[model samples]
Target: MKTPACRIFLFPAMVCFSIIFLLSCTGQKIVSLKTLLMGMTDRTGITQTPSPWYKLIQASSYDRKSDKVGGKGWFANDDYTQFSGVDSSKGRKEYILLDSDGPGAIVRWWMTFAGEGSYDGIIRVYIDNTETPVLQENALKLLSGQLLAGEPLSASVSPETDLKMRGHNLYFPIPFLKHCRVTIECDSIRITANSRKPSIYYNICYRQYEKGTKVVSFSKDELLQNAELIKSTNETLKSSGTISDNLNLYSSSEPISAKDSINVNIRSKNSAISKITLKLSAFDTEYALRSTVLKITFDGFQTVWIPVGDFFGTGYKKTTSSTWNSRVDDQLKMESYWMMPFKKSCSVWLINYGDQIVKADLNIESSKYKWRSNSMYFGASWHEYHQIMTAGAESEGGTGKHRDINFADIKGKGVYAGDAVAVFNTVEAWWGEGDEKIFVDGEPFPSSIGTGTEDYYGYAWSRPEIFSHPFIAQPSGSGNFHAGLTINMRYRSLDAIPFMSSISSNIELWHWLPAIINYSLTSYWYVIPPYEINIK
Candidate 1:
C-alpha cells in the first residue's frame, strides 16, 4: 500500500543494507603500525609517467661547497653563517626558507640554533600565496619528542640522551596546491661569545611535483576532526608484535662445531621471511656471537654477509641494551625484523669461523607476501678497519686530500637503506666529526651530504648518551670520549636513498685529533634481481 516513489526507495535501501550486512559478516579493514611503516617505503610514490622530480631547499647560509675542493652541493656552512630575518619597512621578524611553486610537500625540517634564546621560536607556513598562514606554532612544541595535548601533528624528535644533543627534527607533510612559503621567527640575542646576533642552523627537505598535481594543504581543523584515527595509529605503534592470528612461527636448534656451517632452508611458492631470532649457548658466548657470520641467499643471491653481533649493533662485546628493529639483551639474545622476500626458496646459514662448540637456536617466521616486479631483494654487507689512523690536513676539511670510510660500493638499481657503525676510539677528543657523502648513480660528486656523524644518525652537537628509537639508536656511548667501544645504528624508515645505476656511500674519516681507531660497519640495502652483483 506504499506509494510508487516510496517502494523504489525501499528497494535500493534494502540492497544497500544487504551489502553492508555482507561486508560486516566478512572482515573489516585492518590498519596497524606495520601498515604505516610499509606505506612509507612505497616506491610508487616515485613518479615517472609524466615526469615529476623532487627537490630539497636547504638554507645553509654560507656555501660549504665553496670551502671544500670537491664538496657536495649543500654541505655544512650554518656554523659560519647567520640567517637574518626578511627586512621590511617595519622590522625583520621572519626568515624565509622556502618560497616556491608547489604541488609538493615539505618532507623534513631540521633546526638547531646557537643562542641564549631557547629553541622556542615560532614557525609560519603559507600555502597558495595566501596572506594568512595555514600552519603556525611554536617550533619546539611543534616538533617535540614528547606528545602534545591538542590536535595530533606529524613529527618526531631524536633521543634526548644522545651525546650530540638536541637536533630538532620535524617530519610533518605540508602539502600545497599552488605555492608554499615558509618562515621562522626567533628573538635576536647573543649566542656565542664571538657572535653578536642569534644564529639559527637549519635544513629543509621537500619534494616538488609537476604542475596540475593534486595536493591537500595542511589544516589544523581537519587534524582535530580526525583525532581518533591519529590516536589509533599512536596506540598501534606503541604496541609490540603481530596482532593477527594467521602469523606463522618456526624454530630450530642445532649444535655447531668450530668452522661448521648450518643451513636453514624454507621452501614456499609465494612467501616471505618475516622475522628471525638467533641465540647462542657456548662456553665463550661473547666470542661465538661476535665471530659467527650470518649468510642469507634468497632466491639464489648472496645478499647478506655480516657478523651476528655487528648486525644487531652490539659490537664485539655486549656492553649495552636496545629494543627495536635489531635488539640485543644481556642474556645474549638477538632479533631482527627485516623483511626478506623470495619466490622459489630462501636459505640462511650460520658459519662459525671461531674455534668454539656452540649450540645455536634459530627461530623464523613467515607470511604471505605479494611480490611485485619492481620489488627488490634485501641485501646487507659488512666491512671492518683494524686500526685506522686519522691524519693529515684534508681529513679535517683542510687543504690536504680527504680519506673516506667506504660503507658500501653498490652497483645496479637499489636503495640505500641504512647502516650501523662501531668504533674503538684509542684517544678520543671526539671521534666523529666526519660528514656523510653519498654519491648516487655514478655522479662525479656526492648528491647527498650531511653535517656530522651524529647529525646523520638523528642527534646533534656530538652527544654520546645512550638512546634507542624506532629508526635510529645509540646502544653504547663510551660514557666518555676515550672510554671504549661506542656503537650507533640508523634504519631509514621514511627516507631511503634510491639509485638507478650505482651508489658509493662514504663517511669522511674526520676527527678532532689524529688518533688511531678501530672501525666496523654494516650496510643494509635493497636491490633489483639477477641474483648476482659485482663485489667492489
Candidate 2:
C-alpha cells in the first residue's frame, strides 16, 4: 500500500546562491593493507535501464527432475535459468549488463538447463556503446509473454493466455520486452506438458520498482517528527578516561534524510583533494540499519585514492516516500569500499537506506577546492547531459534492489567495544546444502560451514569452521580483510519487524536452491571516518 510518484517536472529546479564554501582539503587516517592498494582517488557512475530485460524460460526436456514444491520470497516464482539445450556455438556466460563502473543496470548470468522435453535457445543482447537499440523496435510491440499454472508457479512479461492447474502450478505471462540489454536464445523447443519428468527455472532477477510505481515507502502518518527522532548526541563518552558515562549507548547523533541528489564518486587514481573525515553514527543502537557503524577518515596525502571498489552495489532496498510531495531514486548498492590511505584515515559504512543523509556535511576534499557546488545556498547546474547521470532503475520506486539492510565494521567485535557500531543486518545467510551451522559472537563456529571459494571476489564462506584442538575467541574483527569483517548469519523475521520486512529472511531448502539460496554469503568490513579516539 505505497505508491505515488510521478511528477516529472521536466527540468527547472536549479537555485543556488552560495554561502561561503571552502574545504579544499586537510586530514586523513587508516592506512594499512599495503598502503591501500598502492594508490587511491577514483570516481565512476552508470545506470541505464528504460526497457530491455524481459525474462521467461522454464524447460523440461523429458524426465530428469522437476521439483520446486513451494517457496516465496521475491513473490511467486516459475523457475528460470534456461540457456536452453546449449551448444549454440557455446557462447553465453558474461556479466556486467551496464557499468559506467558501477551503480545499477547490471548483468551477471549463468546456465541451468530446464526440463520437461524440447529445449531451445536465443536470448543474447548487450549494448553500452555498441550503438544502443538492443531490443524493442516493434517485434510485435517488442515482446509480451505470460504463463501461469497454479499451486506455486508464475511468470509474466504479461501477454495473458489460457491454462489452469487447480493449485498445483504453472504461470507465465512473458513476451513483452521494454528495458534494454536482453538475452534468451532458445528458438526451437517443445514441452507440450507432462508430469514429474520436466524441469525449468530461471532467476537472475533485475528490473524491479513497481509497487505502485515507487514513492519511497513511508506511511505511519508519514513518519517525520524528525521522523521517529532518535538523535542522541554525546548522551556522553570519555575515551582517554579510557571512556564511560551516561552512555545510553556511548556517542550518537541522528538527523539523516537527504531526499535525493547525492553522488560521492572517487576511486583511488589520485584525484587529489585529500583530508576527509565523515562520521554518521545512528544512535541508541540495537540494530540501527544492520548494526550502525560508519567511519571514513581520509586525510592521507600521497595522491593515492583507491576505491573504484566494484562501484558499490549489490542489494539495497529501503526506498520509500509516498506523500511528502513524491520521490523515488535512491539506487545505492555496494559491497566493497573501505581503504583510506592517501595521507591516511579511511573508514566506510553506508549500510542500506536509500535516499540518505544522516548528519552528513563533510565535503572536505581539496586539490585546491571547488565541489560542494549547488552554490552553497544549494542549487546549480549547467546541463549539457554528456555522461555521469546516476540514480535510476529498480522499476518504479528506485533505490532498493533487495538487500534487507546491513552496516558493519565491528573491528571491535560483538556488542561493540570501542563502540563505532551501526550493525543492521536483521538477518542474512548464504551457504546452503548439508552440514552448516554458524554462530559467531554467541558461541559455535563450525568452520564457516563449507563453500567459500570462487576466485574473482564472489562466493564467500570465510571464517567459522573451528575444530581441531581448540583456539577459540575469534571476533576481534573476524579474520581481518584489512582488519575488519564481523560475523553474522541470522535469517531472522518472526512475524514482522525486520524493519518492516522488505525481505527480512524467509528461505529454507534441504534441496532446491538458486545461487545457493539467492545469496548465501558475501562479506564486507571497513571503518575509517572515526569509530572513536581522535579520528582526525
Instruction: Give the candidate number with the greatest lDDT.
Output: 1
lDDT of 2 by residue, 1-536 (tens): 22121111111112110100111121222111111111111111001011111111112111122121221222111232322233233453322222221011212111223343313333333333232223312111111111111111121111121111000111111111123344443333433443322333232212222222211111112111112121110111100011212211112234545432223434433222223323332332212222222323334321121111111111112221111101112322112112122322322323324344444323334231222211001000010111212222233333312221112112221111000111111112222211122222222221112111110011112222211100011111222122222222211000001010011111212121111121222222222222211111
35: Cα error in model 1, Å: 10
User: How much does candidate 2 score in TM-score?
Assistant: 0.24
Error of 2 at 374 (Å): 9.6
State, as a TM-score between 0 and 1, how close model 1 is to the true structure: 0.79
If candidate 2 were superposed on the true structure by all CA atoms, what would the RMSD be? 24.1
For each candidate, give its TM-score against the true structure. 0.79, 0.24
Pick the TM-score winner: 1
Colliding pairs, model 1: 163-462, 163-463, 163-464, 163-465, 164-460, 164-462, 164-463, 394-400
Residues 294-381 of candidate 1: C-alpha lDDT, one tens digit per residue: 8998888889988888887787777555433566767777778777777778888999999988899998887776676666778888
Lowest summed lDDT across 10 adjacent residues in model 1 is found at: 2-11
lDDT of each: 0.62, 0.20
